[model samples]
Target: MADIKLSGIRKSYGSSEVLHGIDIDVKDGEFVVFVGPSGCGKSTLLRLIAGLETISDGELQIAGQKVNDLTPSQRKIAMVFQSYALYPHMTVYQNMAFGLTLGKKGPLGGLLGGGENKKMIEEKVHKAAASLKLEPLLKRYPRELSGGQRQRVAIGRAIVRDPNVFLFDEPLSNLDAALRVNTRLEIARLHQELEATIIYVTHDQVEAMTLADKIVVLNDGYVAQCGTPLELYHQPANKFVAGFIGSPSMNFLEATVTDIGPEDIEVVLSSGKVKVRLPVLPGDLALDARVSIGIRPEHLQEGSGEVFRMSSRVKVVEQLGEASYLYLENGEDDPFCNEPFCVKTNGHSSIRTGDSVDICAALSAVHVFNASGIALTRTTTDSRYIAPRRA
Candidate 1:
């Protein structure tokens, strides 16, 4: 187990820069996940750390050693890619033992002969297989094993290396939905057992949220935000992070600052139907300054009574057994017309398409972003104000 540190890490292809000045710290035995949308350079950054790709600039240190010029094999890191990359011809045991066999030199560089080396390799393989529950399939070929089993074999191969760091690049992308869940759980358990320093890259936020001790959210080759899952979910640093971390994605509505208090600011929606007093630092916000309000689907409740309320026509309703999502139509005149305003409600909700519904959210649940897409500092308070109901 080793700590990994990246300082101002940058990557480029020809003149086009991909990762721009990224800095992250992974403590020993920590599970850190790099998460973002497609083309966000998360995979590229992982490759850089694995030494699979050369760093265009900045420094990368693994276990306190600078390894910018070290080859992938010399980095003491194991990588499990999206594709299993397993040997179809070799049995599970042979595949896992292949790396150890090639590098085995004993104390005198092969003077001890093959017998002792072979036994050592066998022990390592068996231990890894048992941990992953792959012991029963040790003699099976890649073609004979299920997808999940094959993925486990790949992970087991990495385990035998006893690497200082482990890099997983979308390892669950190829698996089916159910397999992904099971494999994800397996990986979590494996991390707990091995206590290895792990850096995982995935486009799925759910994976990052569930597995990572810290999540690095990348956007357009830059680090958008890095924090615990709940930190990014509850207190996003900016509007982009706010929208990207949640499942249904937070809904945004255009508003202008109508009033500003010492500890809070009041904004009225562009539709002129609702005004909300959000517990946000008023900063240099002037009256009539353009800003946006973000509310998560789960935060928006059906009916009224909260501090903030809005009425909109539901365009679609998706029944998800335990819960239902209502997609509300933002009028053509609204700036957010391109995006649907979604509300999560109880599964038993009778609300259907074209139904007009009044939804409300507490002021504490609202996120306020300035015109520049930067989120204002939201203060913690219990003060609430009831807005007048529209006649």
Candidate 2:
């Protein structure tokens, strides 16, 4: 187990910079995940850590040693790429032994042409194969193995090296849905057994949420937020973090401060005649401020069973067996665009589309943000907002 640190790391191509001073720390044996949309520099950061890309500036330390000048092969790091780059013509055994065979000091040094060297290489291969449950298919070619088998072989190849850090670059992207789940479980087991620091990169939120001890959410080459999956899910740092971390995503509604007093602010939405109360101290709040109110669909309840209620016209309804989302024709400014406020109703819900209904929301479940789309520190309602924003 080793700790990896990046301080003020930056990357650039010509005059256009891709990464802008990213600083992250991975504790010994911690499984960290980098998640973001495509072209968000998640892969670039991984490459930089693997020494595959040059750091434009800043320091990279592994196990308290500066390794910026070290090459990929010398970094004591192993990377499993998305493609599973295996030798098509070679058997699994030969492929796994290739790196060790090229060495002049390892147990497999110059072994392909001799007896003892060959035996050592074969033994190591068998051991790795056994670990990955690939011993039965050692002689099989890459093409002969199924997708999952091939992926295991790729991981086996890395496991044999016994490197300090294992970097996975979207390793499960190529597998089928079911196979991906199976492989994901396998990775979790492998980490428990090896207890090595593993940095995984993937755009799939599910993967990041499920596998990481901490998730680093990146956006436009910057760290948007870093925390446990539930932290990012429950307490997002900003609007972007809130919107990006969830599955159905939080619903945002345009609103104005109707009354701002000492602790709570009153807000009114265009979709309903009801006045919604926001629990936040008015010290930092701007009166008559243009603001946005965000709430998870799951937070909005369908009957009189909730703490607060607001009425709206249901525009569309999507049923998913376990739950349903009611898209309401409710918005002041295009908070969701007719993206409609998705309300997750109960399983086999009795609600229907176009049903004019009263939706209830727990006051504590609301997330209020300023017009700039920055999340506000919500407190219990006091009273401050007394007027709406002037046009």
Q: Pick by TM-score: which candidate is best?
A: 1
Name the runs in model 2 displaced over 4 angstroms: 105-120, 261-263, 270-272, 281-283, 330-338, 379-391
What's the TM for model 1? 0.93
Q: Candidate 2, residues 95-192: lDDT per residue as tens digits?
A: 88876665455345545443336677778888988878998898899999999998998898888777889999999999999999999999999999
Per-residue CA lDDT of candidate 1, range 1-391, in tens?
7899999999999999999999999999999999999999999999999998899999999989999999987999999989989988999999998778757565676455443377889899999999999999999999999889989999999999999999999999999999999999999999999999999999999999999989999999999999888878888889999999988999998899999999999888887778778899988888999998898999888999887888888989999999999999877654344689899999999999999899999888898999999888887653331112223
Give lDDT per model, in order.
0.90, 0.83
In candidate 1, where is summed lDDT lowest over 10 consecutive residues? Answer: 382-391
Clashes in model 1: which pairs? none
- How big is the RMSD of model 2? 6.1
Q: In angstroms, give how far residue 14 of model 1 lies from its true place.
A: 0.6
Q: How much is 349 displaced in model 2, in angstroms? A: 0.9
